[model samples]
Target: MAKLTIVASIKVKSDQVDFVKSQLENLVPITREEAGCVQYDLHQDNENPAHFLFFEIWESRELWQDHTNNDHIKAYQAATEGMVEEFVLHELTHIA
Candidate 1:
């Protein structure tokens, strides 16, 4: 199976940045602990703190799917409900 690359951008409400960032940071260590997780990084935009990014790599699409269904992931979805103003997901493959 081919490895997977995910780039997700989350635009949170300007006033909710700290709470959103805390919630986002909670996902990192847990996701990193998952099997087949190559990398799961969180980044905040220097210019716009309300904009956050997730750069993830998984061993396969299946593993990435597993992550999406995980309980923590579910909780994240619940916790961030409405706090997120916009979200974009991109699934990718490395050429280099």
Candidate 2:
């Protein structure tokens, strides 16, 4: 199967950036432990502190679905609920 990529852009509330980052850090271990995760990284925009991006690569769409329903991920979603300004998710297929 071709690799699946998920790009998520998040805009966080000003004072919530630090807390949101901390929560994202907790996701690292969980993502790494997942069966089909290839890469899962979080990045902060250098010029815009409120901007955050999640770059994720999975072995298959099924794996990505699993990640979405995982308990830790659910917790992360709940935790960030009110602290986010905007959240956009993009799913992609590898071309190379």
TM-score of 1: 0.96
Residue pairs in steric clash, candidate 1?
none
lDDT (Cα atoms) of all candidates against the true structure = 0.95, 0.93
* TM-score on alpha carbons, each prediction: 0.96, 0.95
| Residue-wise C-alpha lDDT for candidate 2, range 1-96, written one tens digit per residue | 799999999999999999999998899988988999999998999999889999999999998998899999899999999999999999999998
Candidate 1: list runs displaced more than 4 Å.
none
**Could you tell me which 10 consecutive residues in candidate 2 have the lowest summed lDDT?**
24-33
lDDT of 1 by residue, 31-72 (tens): 999999999999999999999999999999998999999999
Return the lDDT, model 1, position 38: 100
- lDDT score of residue 80 within candidate 1: 82
Q: Tell me model 2's lDDT, rounded to 2 decimals.
A: 0.93
